[model samples]
Target chain A: MLKKMENNTGNFYIDVASIQKEKHANEICGDVFLTKKVSAEDRTIIVLSDGLGSGIKANILASVTASMAVNFTSMNAPLAHTAEIILSTLPVDRERKVGYSSFTIIDIEAGGTIHFVEYGNPEILYFRENETLELKKTPVTIKNRFRLKQPLFYSNCTGRRNDRIVVCSDGISQSGIGSRAYPFGWGIKNVNAYIRDEISRHPGISSFDLCRKLLANAIANDTFKAKDDITAGVVYLREARRLMVCSGPPYDENKDTMLARDLDRFAGTKIICGGTTANIIAREMHREICTNLSHTSFQLPPVSSMDNIDLITEGILTLGKAHRLLEEGFKPDLVSKDPAVMLCNHFLLHDEIVFVVGTKVNEAHQDPSLPVELEIRRNVIKKIARELEDNYLKTININYI
Target chain B: MTEITICSGTLCYIMGGADIFEIETKLSEMYNDKIRIKASTCLGFCEGENKQNPPCVMVGNELIPDATIEKIINHLKRLYTR
Candidate 1:
């Protein structure tokens, strides 16, 4: 069997997560964040940029800065040269240190080493276990006509389990402004204290959940209205946790015993999709299937549960909705308390995903007018697999039976 | 017009169910003009490792497991006659 996990060469797994606070309900987030996973070296490169002011102007500047940083890193250009070129082109403020658009470059490897580079934006917080890991800040000026005093920070730390590196824009620190509770704003001290408290309260918090918790608090501190456009990136290193999802049914009934045994022997979570597939597995394994007839998704049918199966749902429609959700974007609160949403969240949480697809087509789904054929259904699975790799940075393997 | 799709997936093709491919030339004279015969990577019906029903075919949305050429032709006749 081909290994579905990326832990073959590396001792650590990287969970890269980010969240952004938009200026308004309908406007694009001014703080642009980009993440690219280098397949050759298994390295994760992240760039966060906060443009001058907010709205479209800031969005454009931040987008340009973030993309340029990503492009430069992919080309293996010198960090200093890339920084110099980015600063020279942008209109820097005389009062601030190479100010116009601020950036933080984080290059993390699967082997537990952190290559952190920061300029203009707020300091990157390094955390190990629960407490903060402080690095000495040394000011290295970027040579320019205005004598730019950008802080050139370079630090390397070998990551262990539960090691986290957080980078954020000024918007996070500037939260709670104009509020009675915090006359100035939620400073770096408060943010650090909150993070430390959360870490201590709950161990093994995921990078995505941690980033989201901070963003949510920041927004709430401004009395349900964010004081500024905020952005946060939380990168974590740990061992990989693999998950197996068995969907559809095999082509022949004679193969049911092997399929049942495969599910029973799977070390990770086993999910059975489709009613007929679940029934076969249930019958073969002699396990009771408790189905929840509650309509979970508006478009898709409700979910079912078996004694051993982690999750069970109607096959194609649920997968379709899950694919759409991932494609549209990763928003935790999009469709709260739904089966498809729950499945998508589970998919995001796991590092590796194994899809066991059954090559059986359902007659109920076929209609002359509907165009729900075997080919269309198989295409849907392929589309879902592609979205998982592209959007979530997960290692996925598809086994067709 | 009727559409006849044969499952050519790993399980179906292996079960000798994909024999529809061999008889397409013979059926072309009798029903080729009235029906569309196509081979699909997976006709979506043989999911269980239980190859009890090795070959599968789809006429419209109806699945015919343990499908043979005669079974498929009869299914097509029934589908179109209705």
Candidate 2:
């Protein structure tokens, strides 16, 4: 768990919490900050991504999405346009079909303007003094028809001051406070009322605390374990804010040079790499890279920050799909129109970023030197990028190295 | 000339490996003047899970799984030599 106080023009704080359940062999759902950067005004902008399907591949989709979104949103571009650019930029995997991720964006301006947009999940609830609740649900949603489920755009209502927004995945909802499957097709009012009546009570309670209560409520209601990874993000708005960008170990050996190059161009350059990359990069750059003996995974850098892109990814998809439905002309009080949201919200994190690193084939029992299916995968990536208007970085930025 | 079929459906693409299309390209390059290759939407087998076994191949009435370029080439070689 990590906490930071922002000294920006606005008074704002954020409390985030995520929990994953072993839903089976293949499903895992979590949240991720695609990328994080402090805006010129010193406020923090966060984007969450939820990849389609579950388990490791789903984690990678959400991870890459959060990383890219965080990296670009810092530029303070229009969220809609920035989202479009990101959609266009992702590399599509032929096996997983990686063109889309459920996205939710929270922008805390210096003056404390909380702009919230969700694409998949429903609007998070704000519970405060006397159980006064605020639910900023999107006006539209993507509903899954029997067949022909396509990505749809939706619009979001503006944010209210000091409104605590609780964004989450269906896993959180399905788990529900009572542990009975979330009353399918239940509206935000029902969700909000349940939280207010059962969970949120007390002033200045951190959002993360509220998240825990919500998850605990769900678990306590039923005797069975959750079948999916559960994720929840809470954003508290006041007036002040600060931002942190968590970097992780490189997927490839050349990451040392890449880090040096990226750090040279960006200000407040803090190089945080993990494990072998951490040791080598820190030694070469003369910077400190945090170490953890508990986790041997190569993705220790960003995960070390506790932002845990895996969790954020689930939040993004649930929220992004919710937002898309609103944009496409659905009402928050109505049913969602997108089926991808349901399928995408079902997974957990991967041990490493897939396909991007290692030889053409690694330990997956394939030939290492051969490019396997590069052309097909590349085409899928290109088609998605073109359709979504995302800036897919086809070539690794050698300048970073 | 050799005829090649590439299935782009969900299951075939998934079980067949996304890189299966390279087989056609490799064959084309190796026997550039000898074969004609193209892509098709679905081979009717990928729709149901039953037809989705590994290395699924159809030559006349023969269904081959774990079908590789070598196997494909040898089959073609036999037909051509005959």
Candidate 3:
């Protein structure tokens, strides 16, 4: 998996989960996927299936369907046609088995264009910028051919960068938890709202953290000790690799001189600016800067802002606008070479410093109020930091400070 | 008098034959407040282990597996007619 991640391009990610529970002799319900990043071409293929029934049989059903779909798609089959073949070739229910699996396929190119094919209820949700969309089959399940024939056919669509795509099993929408034991499925309607809140809280979060938080919340809401299998995948897109450059606080008292000198130098690199730093830079430059609220350079006849200051505000707004511009089904990725960054004179900033009172002899001291064992906190924190370091070298910058 | 409780989670619902309300209606018509019917959440009986032998309903202390409308009706008739 690490090898695959290292070689993958275009910021593609996938998540898979299942449970063999004591509640059911056959935990047949869950999802299966055959995924790989085609590094050379920067295209990623993700084929997923939700098997019929529970336990081993259901697992086999979904596994066969996913394996076949991925194999065929890798041969370059078109998304819709590939889905049709998988649907048609199944057991066909001739022996009164009444078994079939839901399937979806997505092919994302290096340029961040997403092509999707979906059949059955497990849907593909797109959250671009912060707007979400669901590309799903009709709500009614396709148990028999009669149901499959109506306008209830599966759907296919394509989208572009700064857009996010989420694929989920029906289990997530159906799960229940909490005092009222409310269902936390987020369904199609609330998946976007949920993602937007998560992204806003933890802007640099990895895909794994997002998936874990969603499932954990679902479990907490469920009254049953055991829950149905839950799975959700998030893919964020951008027109170019987004570079968030954090400038350290200003080193000197000459604020205007520092801003004027530092702003132009960073601007010369052509990276757009945002946040408070962009505003400060614009005020110092004393000129109107160009920017777009839509974040899309393609909007209208292409309205560009007036000066460098306006341009920097436009850039900051552009990032916000980019997040705002996404509706459901959009996948965000670098669509162009325009990288967006924050402009600053190192820093006019916010910093927090906490005083520590600990047993210097122990290096860590136990809290009398905590019910946990003496060393549990230290051990748990160490284990989590180790895991974070192992999985996400990019996001987990483990500086002790 | 016989008491019946049915499971209401997603799988049991999918398995169908909940029919608790109809069973209650039938009992009220036949026994006139002599019998009681209730709906409950999952009894933790999932597929595979039950091997699709579910749609469970508890009648007193005895569990009726693969419960159907006919099964409940028969059980109630046998217990209450006496």
Best by DockQ: 1
Predictions in order: lDDT: 0.72, 0.43, 0.46
Compose the digit string of candidate 1's lDDT tens values, residues A63-95: 888988888877778878888777777765444
DockQ for model 2?
0.01
Order of candidate numbers by lDDT, starting with the best: 1, 3, 2
After superposition on all C-alphas, the RMSD of every candidate to the true structure, in Å, is 11.7, 21.9, 28.0
Interface RMSD against the true structure, candidate 3: 25.3
DockQ, all candidates in order: 0.02, 0.01, 0.01
**A113-162: candidate 3 lDDT, tens digit per residue:** 55676766545776655656655543323324333541224444445434
What lDDT tens digits, residue by residue, belong to model 2 across residues A1-401?
11223434432334343444433455555445432426356455666666656677667767777776666666656655666665666557577554666777766555545556666655545544435454344443232222223343433333333446666665556554443444442345665676665444455555556666766655543344654555666655432221111123344666657654444444331222122323344455565422122222211111122111111111111223423433353322313223223212211100011111112111211324332322232233223223222221111111111
- TM-score of each model's B chain? 0.75, 0.62, 0.73
Query: What CAPRI class is candidate 2?
Result: incorrect
Per-residue lDDT for B40 in model 3? Answer: 45
